[model samples]
Target: MGEHPRRRADAQRNRDRLVAAASAVIAEAGPEASLEEVARRAGVGSATLHRHFSSRAELLEAVLHDRVRTLCALADELLTAPGAGTALVTWLRAVVAHAATTRGLGPALTGYASDPRFSPHTMIREAARQLLARAHREGSVAPNATVDDVLRLANGISLAVDSLADATECADALITLVTDGLLRRPANG
Candidate 1:
């Protein structure tokens, strides 16, 4: 028998729900967590989770795509802020804060070795490139800095923070120091 139209739509909804819930859960639990656990957290059947993600790597990739989109949107919105320095600072701080909470992102998607097209990472990089270019042109960021360099530094900071047992202060300090280095300096200095 043909599947009912309502049934197909409901299945799609279940898939979307599973994807979103799995993203959050995996960010906390890492990619090795059981699919049944993900399903339970998502309030969906294990079969439903499998239908959407198929495998752990697929779910991880989907989560990275979602996060990349979110970060890119944040960069786009921040780029239009009243002050360029303020915008850069705000975005950097947001990245650090986001990094502190989200596991595996530093190593998986944001690193220099990772493929830019790995998930929606290219979009995020392009967004960062545009913002960093503007920040440089506007004399808000260091002239010689590339977006890749910034991301590398951010990834390094995120990794360092991730290792500390109680690193809230350390994370904040490191992010602030990096932000200071990223700032533009006057020619006369």
Candidate 2:
């Protein structure tokens, strides 16, 4: 019994290491980074990598899922922040930053768009939706602003800068454009 539990723990550790390695390799070389590199980085054999992740997509999913969870948690926490619009803007910027820094992330994460139960795409949308809803209630942003709009904007920014040198910094500035629609003010001054 103890041996079985130990094996399970070891397997879990291997999975964690694989995920971590995949994340780093992907971030460095883009989504098309070699699987062999991942296994080597993880200090695991190719067979072990295959055992943990059948395909590159699955491994990417795990990485994106891990990051998405943290992003969602941040969105939830920001709900109580003083400025709803600013909080939403802040979260969106972070989302864009993640996308820009993590090359190929947009496509990798969007691959699960149809998964009803647990999709990184769905998770991010729902998180943004929550923040957008609060912004709507507070009349802090444009009434027509949707989570789709924000996400699309983020994706576009990510793509535009994917080949650029200072992509992350570029993404940070470009994300501010999204606030134009979300935080627009009346001209009744």
Candidate 3:
């Protein structure tokens, strides 16, 4: 027989808490953060955490999947925004922010790049592609700009400023510089 609905809901809630706690702990304590700490943060026991995610890799994958889903959703919402160029810039900034927070998990995520079920790389690429296409169509961005270019630039900026005393400000400044360069110039200018 199937599991009881309330029990299933409770299980799902526990899973959500674990993922959230893991994300927070990892963001603050790096990828090496303890699973026990994650359980503590979630207000659940270690056993519950294990029941939901058998291993660290599985937990990290879940966190990455959740984050990527969020980014993709943001891209979709921004696609219909009033200004294509602005939307692209906004989306890129968000991507950079997420990258900064998840930097510690970079190595772990790389291993899952080949695993179709857990990989967020493709979704991220497609989101960038859609945003870039819209900006190009609107004539707000350089004709030659590619998704790879934007992603590389954002990732670079994120990594470069991650350790600065004013990292947020620095990132914004760098993004502005890049966005200005990306803008389409008038033929007569």
Most TM-score-accurate candidate: 3
Answer with 1 or 3, whichever has the higher lDDT: 3
Flag clash pairs in model 2. Answer: 141-182
TM-score of each: 0.74, 0.76, 0.88
Which pairs of residues collide in candidate 3? Answer: none
**Superposed Cα deviation of residue 186, candidate 1 (Å):** 17
Error of 2 at 91 (Å): 1.5
- CA RMSD (A), model 2: 4.1
lDDT of 2 by residue, 1-189 (tens): 356988999999999999889888887898889999999999999999999887777888788877788899999999999889999989988887787757876566565543356677778989999999999999998899888987887788888887888888888877766555456677997
Residue-wise C-alpha lDDT for candidate 1, range 35-131, written one tens digit per residue: 7887887899888777886666667666666666778888999878877767766776667666765666445433334344564546756877877
Alpha carbon deviation, residue 22, candidate 1 (Å): 1.7
lDDT of 3 by residue, 48-75 (tens): 9999988888898888888889999999
Model 1's lDDT to the true fold?
A: 0.72
Clashes of 3: 0
User: In model 1, how many backbone clashes occur?
Assistant: 0
Indicate the residue-level lDDT of 164 in model 1.
67
